[model samples]
Target: MIVDESIARPIAASEAHTIEADVAIVGAGLAGSLARAVLVRAGYRVVLIDKRTVPPDEFRVEKIGGRQLDLIRQLGFINDLEAVGAPYNRVLNIRDGKVVDISVGQAFGLSYASLVGMARGLLSDPTSFLIDQVTGISCSDDRQQLELASGKRVTSRLVILATGMASPLAYSLGIKRRMLAERHSVSFGFTIARPDNAPFEFDALTAYGERTADGVDYLSLFPIADGMRANLFMFRDPTDPIMRELRRDTKRTLLRLMPGLQRYLGDFDVVGQVQSWVMDLSVVEGHLQPGVVLIGDAFQTNCPAAGTGVSRLLVDVERLCTDHVPRWLETEGMGADKIAQFYSDQGKLAADRHSLDMARFRQALTLNNDARWSARRKLHFLRRMITHRVDRIHPGWVTRVRGALR
Candidate 1:
């Protein structure tokens, strides 16, 4: 999601040397943009900066949760989004062409939200809410200042690092968090270049725990963003040649890997790129010092396969900028270091929970091929029996339980 805004003309010496504001943001990714939006509305002289402004256009958050969408609408981008999205309702886990498990997704019974396929532009468009973009941040003497790649320096009183996974400014503050490489990464299923604009079925999501002759586990395929496309995601074995093909010739590899997809997306041409969560951010925990705070993935999000990173970040920001920050501003003033510890504590708990859940899910899919497959089936049944209790703790996860019961 990085852009190259370096082509902009050079500025005057006066303007290029020094700049200052009340708040300085480091990155312009999804979380950063949202952080900027909330701050601007709060009347803080905000200076949001990024290394670049290239703007994204391909895969973004496939479909946001209910609360996340509300923020986008508040920021005035939902209207721009409707044109590309198709309502997604159900989650189906199929096996060899038969429906093995039907997940009653959130949309079926409640006022749950829908997910859509989006271009990167929709994900990174919060520049309007900032004082200036295409600027980088650095410290000028004793105070914090922003130095654009173009050599423009802007200073600020309170600096907020919404900078994503790689926070250059936060690193400067001596907060370098580390993450595991996603060799065991999660692969997202997507589709592109379908024949028609017809809506994807409300019952669109499906998972297949199937094994090939070599015993590789992969997810089943279904339509996304209207019936225009469908996809199957399997654990890519580095040893397999298809893994290489899947990256370069995804259209052909998808059809070759699993025959099930051919029936659903055969007529229309399918296009896509394989996305993985290779970045596991565990560093930068101490990035928040007396003057700054690290929110979102910049702090720590999740391991591979857990889809809770974005949601948890949104929740973290909502709690911090909305509730906690104001209280601190009134009572003890700013202790950015304490705030970072507080967020890391809360965020780690959430991340741990998601990591465990994804581990269980991966185990569930893996079990079908193991001798413990029967035990796994019993475990799934037991989970279905106590879904209500689980739902309270996992609003997003309970949907999958319902999918299983149906």
Candidate 2:
């Protein structure tokens, strides 16, 4: 069987679980939990479920975005982030030394220091509050429900399928599920000491100083868990020569990506095992049924390499709860348009805009083109320049932005 981290403990394909809730939420990951929180704050009772009793941060980037850094502070999860985490500030965009784009820590105008690090839990209290962690879900016109493997059932008024790409519950509810075996990729390396420490220990950096023959793919470096950790990623397009040099597994992948770290293996051993996912480009346009809301990963699983996964999901939640739900709930004859609009808007943003941006970034930095590299240099400089101007004109912006800047 293909290895899947869909659960805390892997289960055979035959295993069947059941449950229900007022708002039955599937998946305990970031998107699922955040959506649950929004619904609960709106005064709806939620019964959240996931296949695994104890979900681990297995394949996650474990790094949050500029917007989420703000959300985390408001959600009261900042302490949780501090209890188990690292911070980031600098971003290094490198390409064979000829083209280098470095955004110094907190020195960029638009760049809010983002949050990158491990956390005590999932940092998803909204759904975690209910925390049933069941496997399967079944909803009807009358009410919604979830089914755990042990035969436990919980019911709710509405159902949110935040269950992510791993959910078979998706197919059961008539949501078309597809997978892209390629295009989904990531790698990590560790740095035990600070890069010339000062008053701060947390900063983020990105590097892509190498490129392949076609110039469509390259390798990159970014910080996670503040300056305490670093990740080296090898992105290769189909024809790229770098693909031939990929390490089959995660550990070898790291070493293959960054040979310089060979001496420090023991100092900062891999804290989490190497993990990969299909990085599916699938989208559910309109579910085959009503009363089933596909939120977060269940709806679409974008590339996490860009560090925008969490931010996109938050944008999804904001659009849905703020716009669609109220009208749909009150409508006597609600059609697919009720929910489809929000989902469609998000899907377009993902497939067309975000996806292209990630692809461009993966190509520009990864493939090692001179023009692309120079363009990136100007952009980072422009961004930081704009940020500085805004800061002098508005000191409050920098303070608020700095907290989110990792």
Candidate 1, residue 153: CA error in Å? 2.6
Best by TM-score: 1
Whole-model lDDT for model 2 versus the true structure? 0.50
Question: What TM-score would each prediction reach against the true structure?
Answer: 0.68, 0.64
lDDT of each: 0.51, 0.50
lDDT of 2 by residue, 24-135 (tens): 5666566666566555555444555655544554545445546566656655456555545444466544333332434544221110122221221433433334444456
For candidate 2, which ten residues in a row score worst on lDDT? 108-117
Considering every candidate listed, which one attains the maximal lDDT? 1
Model 1, residue 68: distance off in Å is: 4.9
Per-residue lDDT for 77 in model 2? Answer: 56
